[model samples]
Target: MRYARFTGLISVLVANAIPGTALGQSVRIVPDLTTNSIVVFQGVDETAHFYYVPLEMDFVRAADGKPRLGVQYFKEGDGDSWRVAVSTSIKPAASDSELAALKAKLPKDNNVTLSPLVLDFASSYVRFSEAKKPTIFSLESGTLSAGSSIAMKFEFTGTHDAVLQALAASGPEVGVMAIITPDASLVQGEELVFSGAAVADLFEKEKFLLLNSFDESNAVVAFIINGNHSAEAAARSWLKSKLGSPEIGKDDKGVWRYGWDLTRPELLADLRSSPKISLPTFSNVEPPNKALLLPFGNICKDYPDNIVNLETGTAGCN
Candidate 1:
């Protein structure tokens, strides 16, 4: 894994303390809902350094089902160039006090705050530029047989400049976003629906998309589909169609999953098989689980995980 090489680089960046010119640096943490990973951008003026820290174990979940971390540091990478490194032996703090103590070691003046922005793949749409007034192609509608070459746009927030920068710098490539389907919605035979209205509702409530940058607001994102497989199977099939057949197998919990083995160049060529626009990062998230931890490192000891509110620290669970 490319991220395996940056283990020491992360320690030097996080533990050695921010440089004396710390005022010029900006640290923003955003939850990538698609991958269930925390994406941190250490922005310095126009250029930014990126880090992707996965919540592998002992993490909390927000009301909206987003994963929250308690001072975690594990993976580091350059989003612009697509080089990643992760620590293998690192783990989350065992207790709240220990987590706090670990946090205290950070640079005193450092402003490490979470960003309201997030990247979601639950419902995705692509806008075609061939028409006078761009038409939308919804991935949920099924396979797009619009020939081999097609042009389209994927909408995203302007606040995601760092992510956009990374994608733009990487040039043409297939960008994959993990699809997180709720257990309740997992009907075996029924097809799942992801509509633009749902995305609009989410944006209206959270203001997740802030169209500040004209250049970064929208990018060419491809969501190709074919055949009549179930939603989950369709997702896997889409990847397989683009990146070739994946390693089909079961996980430790016996749940089936698809794994792909290809170099960066090969993956990019396969994704760009058709003359289409491409994004940089690509991955998926697993299904939801019970016994989720709180953002403050408190475990919920009851059912209906959504009832426990992080703001008031109330709702019965202790």
Candidate 2:
């Protein structure tokens, strides 16, 4: 029973991380509500560099129902693989002594050390928000630079795999962030390329539109439906009428899922008009457990078993 309760919390928290609302094109500044404080973007040219700074505390409830402050960064233009995120926990520190203690506990190996601006950025950025924008800033390389925030540059000593392993082992005692960079030699040649935000945009629509997998060749788009059996049945039947037969399943938390094949032209036609699922506003949504990480690091997995979250000592599987 305790296991079941933990799993239920995991499901809700995981769902909460999903961006509650769509972002507008005009520099949608959001607090990085997770651990990653400074996001560093490496450019195609060795000299090109840019960053996004979150200027305030974006607090969200973890699975344990405790509030965690986080920040997020965004960059426009084509995608680049040399993106690194650095984050730490400072809000929980009640005093200067406590903050120093926490900083002392940070990892120094693998070139992972606390930034001098870590505390200042944490304390000062928390003061700025969507309502109260930062007065001083500049746009560089398609990213918003909060000029006042401390600049951070991290150097990892090993390969991407080794760095990732080191990061996973850092634990909650020290805040750790992940960098998405390729290990291959070709990475140097990797230039920014356009990725359709169609999927991301569709997520905002909350409609029964096609949710393609990372490999866009797949024919099915799977979506989560929040409702009881009757509601699920109604949705399923309605979908069947429009798009024909679909694979239906329920998650461990009893959320309904509908998977439709896009290979069929007729289904594709109907899918464009499939009804949108009305979701609760973002303000009402709760954040997922920070301890519990997303399965395969993908936020939009289908089954709960694919989702994993870390408990105190043991790892909880979806």
Candidate 3:
């Protein structure tokens, strides 16, 4: 793995268990459009579920194991089954003993063998498989270029088509961060402060200044997405009156920022208010909040001034 070689994947977590506990069995992570934290669940449903914690990134250990990310391995109320999200430093057990311990604690109902799964602890880019499908997790070696179109999950499809179509039809928004590679390719773009259909579209960091999604609350979009160069160009053409040709300049510090005095105020306002989008929730997973699907994360591991909250767990089989 690279220094910060991290990626995303929907995975199974590990924890201990007790007999006769009817707490939960499966994990359900709902990126609440209403806030920055995710509503974590296990058990048959949400009501019996417990622990709504922060979905951290990269480090398996999040600053004293501050509830990193992972799906619960055993049912709810089971000993430590929900405490998962591997740390880089804490090595996993030598296999057999760990899995055996897990299998023993789980209910006779659909007991499973624990599998080591990779994760993009930062971005929630995952498609869970009901049939226990195997997955491959890889990382991009370099950052994308400026002006290059970046797509989320180049291997996945239909990330946020409807919203991308809207953005493609509408001009770009302010306070939004569009990712670009060194070569000026529009690798990806994001509306850091917006939600709903708008968030369904943004997938990368902002090259320009960032806008707060909310006061002290960074409730970002729930899904990863890519910019459609063709669609964006076509949309800009359609909304010429609202869009303007502005100068892209850098400050003394060499940070890239867009000069937007000529941009449409209405468009800017719309983009500014588009944060906090609700993703479609799964009734089968957790029924209480059907309108609770969205993405929440930051591209911090590789960031220069960033801090890493490393964590580790010592789980053993009974």
lDDT of 3 by residue, 12-81 (tens): 2222322343322344332331123222323323223222222222222355543222211112253322
Model 2 spans with C-alpha error above 4 angstroms = 1-145, 150-318
> For candidate 1, what's the RMSD?
30.2
lDDT of 1 by residue, 66-121 (tens): 43321111112433222211111111213445334434443455454311111122
Give, for candidate 3, the lowest lDDT window spanning 10 residues: 1-10
Sort by TM-score, best first: 1, 3, 2
Residues 146-262, model 2: lDDT tens digits:
222222222223333332332343211112222111111111111111112332344335433332231122211222222222233333344445455556655448967765433
Error of 1 at 259 (Å): 55
Query: All candidates' lDDT scores?
Result: 0.27, 0.26, 0.26
Q: Kindly state the number of residue pairs that clash in model 3.
A: 47
Clashing pairs in 1: 3-84, 3-85, 3-86, 60-293, 143-225, 176-282, 178-284
TM-score of each: 0.17, 0.15, 0.17
lDDT, model 2, position 26: 13
- Give me candidate 3's TM-score against the actual structure: 0.17
